[model samples]
Target: MNVKTEVKQIGLYINGKYVPSSSHRTFEVKNPATQGVIALVSEATEEDVNQACLAAREAFENGPWRTMSVAERCEKLRRMAEIILERKEEIAGLDAIDVGKPYHSTVQHEVPRAAHNIHFFADFVQMQGGETYPMEENFVNYTRYEPVGVAALITPWNVPFMLTTWKLGPCLAAGNTAVIKPAEMTPLSVSLLGEIAKEAGIPDGVVNVVHGLGSVVGTALTEHPAVDLVSFTGSTATGKRIMKNGADTLKKVSFELGGKAANIIFEDADLDKAIPGSIHAAFMNSGQVCLAGSRILVQRSIFAEFLERFTKAAMELKVGDPQNIDTKMGPLVSEQHYQKVTSYLEIAKEEKAKLICGGKRPELPEYLQKGYYLEPTVYVQENPKSRICQEEIFGPVVTLIPFDTEEEAIQIANDTEYGLNGVVWTENLQRAHRMSHSVRAGTIWVNCWFVRDLRAPFGGFKKSGVGREGGHHSLEFFTEAKNICIALK
Candidate 1:
């Protein structure tokens, strides 16, 4: 595949216009699959982030967006969904090239999911209603939900576009204005949302996107007094920093952070389904997912057989050009991330864990030789407390551990500090139910992986995250509730 070295210019979108940064500073965004410059994006200064926050604040407080009828608001959101689908291919391609995700996966799954997120939230806000309480004859009290003012949405590089929409949908649906700071590495697709919002007839300043580094832009946004609340998705350490930044202003903070999820297969499990499902759980998006099951636990009865089949399946995955439809995996999002992931191979060896299948870059065409490509890696570690088993590698890596009993499996799964997501595979109905409840993570999957319902509350426990989003949980986080009382004459 021929890689494009042409650099497209991208700018900050504030107050309904695309403009260069106040300082006119720019940064290069590289294609991880080719190590070539894909775009030169405007780097937001603290002043630029302040401008975006002020614009969002003004919009939420004085614009017609909040005063618009519910029907009109929903219609505009629905239109945003429509435009997202209409331009799905273009958007998907940008993400594929910028984030090094497979084009097919981005188009087929992430793009549609982004559209669905907007559509679902648009409809959900309409059906949502306040609660009423009847006092003793003389008076009645009722609760009304009002939108929180300005929101600062800080999204991660992995699955950038989809996650941005995931936050944008609820924030806008509830009448809040936004200042989004997408991850600097994959800003291409998300920068297009400013135009999408404008074309959908959303009012000016209601949606603002600033492209820049986290230290400057992200810090300013989180600490900005004009920003009412922050919804962030990224590393746990960053989440804590945002919390501290918001402390002075007492900003409401919701975070979806790191994870080292566990996927357990019991002796009674069907290997046919478990093997492939486990593969998808661990290696999806090259294992950059927050919910990636990096820890795989198999019962002693089937450990050897499961490892053999799983290793072969993982080894067969095609890792190359993101543009290729048959490519199952792509490079890490950037050279820095590639280095971070590869460092774990050394950590695994130092921990005395045995490498079961892969840990090296694969042989590819000369065109892709410079790409940050690594084979799907599997390891066997007897110590559940090993760094390879406990920490998140955030790459195409999985550590296999064998357990003799269901009780031991649960113990091994719950040993991690992360409680984001987990999986249990078993034929015994009783055992499945027991394991699901025993796992400490949020959103445990029984005989499945990544099946999500928009209505369910989605967030992590422990170090994974702080609050929940999705369905009414999103509404709760994005809005403030007030009780109104009336006296009867």
Candidate 2:
């Protein structure tokens, strides 16, 4: 199944078409589950990025796409969704190879949801428009939710298919053109999306994909003066850099950055739900996710019991190849990530935290030796200031800290500088709502963890980065208001 035999096995997608990079340089897409070269993708240089940017600008300002009405755009977007559903296999296979998600999840979840995302945005594009305000004077007053010229969308590799749709859906729905760069580590899935967009009858220059090192293409996308807005999803450190870069152009920026989400387990939480939900929150996506519940805050009354049940669940997760439908845990994204995660394990020991269960490699198939495998790990830290408790330990690792009072637990949860998300586990409704509000994160879950509705806003406060994504926030990112008035007799 050398699907790479297809036209863009690895190439830049610009003007609604795939083409080889002007810079002969290219990079290998690795299979995180196997650590093999999945495919060779074209690596765009700074110049190539400018080319994409120019095309997006031309499209936004003067091309046929710019003049297209909301009804026209929706028709094309809906057609793209239909094409995506028809090409779901190709898209799913690309995602699996590019990022090592399980085949079943790729085909069943990522591809289908992405198509619906396109359709979802298409459904609303026609309905969303500018507003008119009534004024006492004789002047006509109106406002438009107009496009913000060229948009630069940079997505991470963790959930490439899902988040690309998250960013692109609203950008397109609001009539903005884009130059999108999926993370270098997992560009294929979104590249496959490029093909679907072309097949869907979208005119050239509306959407462009440039796959390359972020240092080169990413820098160009964020800082390009032609880019009117930037939408990014990644670490806080990088988000800061992008923000600084966008400032040079005084460009609008929307970021979905880092998280060290707090997962609280109170004395009265139902152990059955709390136990499994905590494990799913911390270890889903092998804990490579940004919004993972990596910091576990437990009430002193149930700390020991929660740790016991939580560690038990962590140890039982099936650590094996992603291709296996039965495997609950897959490899981390890459060797770099694998090393980063393992080093944190050593950090826990040096910091003198109590290692609960599975902390090292799993003795699985010999082939996994070449992959980025990590067993689930949980630790009990003495305090909230522990380095592991504060940092984004982006792996199957979590630090559990105990607090006596509800007030203390809330304080501990809000202790981190990264207030991206949090989880509140309690049986009492009033207590759950209070605790959720008390936590400083942007989005809080009560009696649940890691669930999302696209219609809701998603982002963070403080160092977690600025602005928001999903729902109306996304459309707003792609729009800017302009006021015009004239004196009349």
Best by lDDT: 1
Instruction: Please give each candidate's TM-score.
Output: 0.99, 0.95
Highest TM-score: which candidate?
Answer: 1
Model 1 per-residue lDDT at 246: 96
What are the per-residue Cα lDDT tens digits for candidate 1 across 144-204? 8889999999999999999999999999999999999999999999999999999999999
Backbone clashes, each candidate: 0, 1
Worst ten in a row by lDDT for model 1: 1-10
lDDT of 2 by residue, 4-110 (tens): 43334678998878888997777887777767776788889888899999999998898877678888888989998888888887887777666766667677887
